[model samples]
Each structure stands twice: as structure tokens, then as C-alpha cells.
Target: MNQFKNGDKAYVIYRNPHTQNVATIQEAIITESPENNEELSLFLMDTHYPLQDDYAIYTTYEEAVKMYNYYFEDNEQSEM
Candidate 1:
């Protein structure tokens, strides 16, 4: 069974095709079950579509955002 619920929050890091960098790492809501029973998909609440189903699923909203911000910051630091 999937760990995510309909309103659960999650984070997905996707690479930008053009820049080959972090495209988007934002908070998402799980609106539906994942394609596979063992995996959880990222669902954009606004778009009403699954962004991706192959990443980490944070236990809380803060946790997910914190991880995203940290990664983003680390990438920025590396760019400097």
C-alpha cells in the first residue's frame, strides 16, 4: 500500500531539460494513488496532475520544504 493520502504533501526534484539544473522542487499535494502500488507520485495540486512518482516523500510539510530549500541553497552555493 502507498504511504501517501489524498491530501498528503510531498516534494519532487526534477531536472530542467534546458539548463540541466533543478527545474522545480516545490510542495505538492497527493491527489491520487500512484501508478504502482509500491511507489508514490508527486501531484501538483494546482495542475491536478502527477509531476513524478519517484522521489522522497516527506512526513510533514515543513520537512519537505526544508529539504527542498537546503538542496536549492546548496546548488546555488556550488554555482558561485
Candidate 2:
């Protein structure tokens, strides 16, 4: 299992049962999911503004960081 720590950036991937469109992880919140027997859930904020919602979770901190960099790499590349 991947270990996720607080403050780590992550990408949430989930398909809404209704729309069936892939959801984006705009934000990551490390917390426990009461419905899943207190298992840790990475709360993801949807990229769709005004409809922001928690989407999915990452198994490890490294995975989360990788996702973050992948999504926002343009900014880093410009700095280099």
C-alpha cells in the first residue's frame, strides 16, 4: 500500500456514476474516511470551479508529489 502524508500533493481520479466523465484532483486533503472504516482518504477538490468536491486518494506520498509535478511542471520548467 502507498503511504500518504499530510501536505503532500496528489491527483484524484474517479468516474462519477452519473456523468461518467473523469474527474480531476484540484486539491488534496489527507483525512480519514468514516464510511471506509476510518481508512485514510485523500480528499480531492474537483478542478471544476464552483463544483469543487473531494474525488479520490493516493496510496503514497511519492505518488502524490509526482502527480503534482506532472500537473504543474510548466511553472517549474520556466524557472529552470
Give the candidate number with the greatest lDDT.
Answer: 1
Q: What tens digits encode model 1's per-residue C-alpha lDDT throughout 1-80?
A: 16667667766554565896555666677765456644444565455554334555565657766776777877798999
User: Candidate 2's error at 71, in angstroms?
Assistant: 16
Per-residue alpha-carbon lDDT of model 2 for 4-80, expressed as tens digits? 54445555554455775333434455555545633555555432211134534465456755665665555568779
Clashing pairs in 1: 41-53
Q: How much is 40 displaced in model 1, in angstroms?
A: 6.6
All candidates: TM-score? 0.46, 0.35
Worst 10 residues of 1 by lDDT: 45-54
| Model 2 bad stretches (over 4 Å) | 32-39, 45-80
The number of clashing residue pairs in model 1 is 1
> Each candidate: what lDDT?
0.61, 0.49
Residue-pair clashes per prediction, in order, are 1, 1
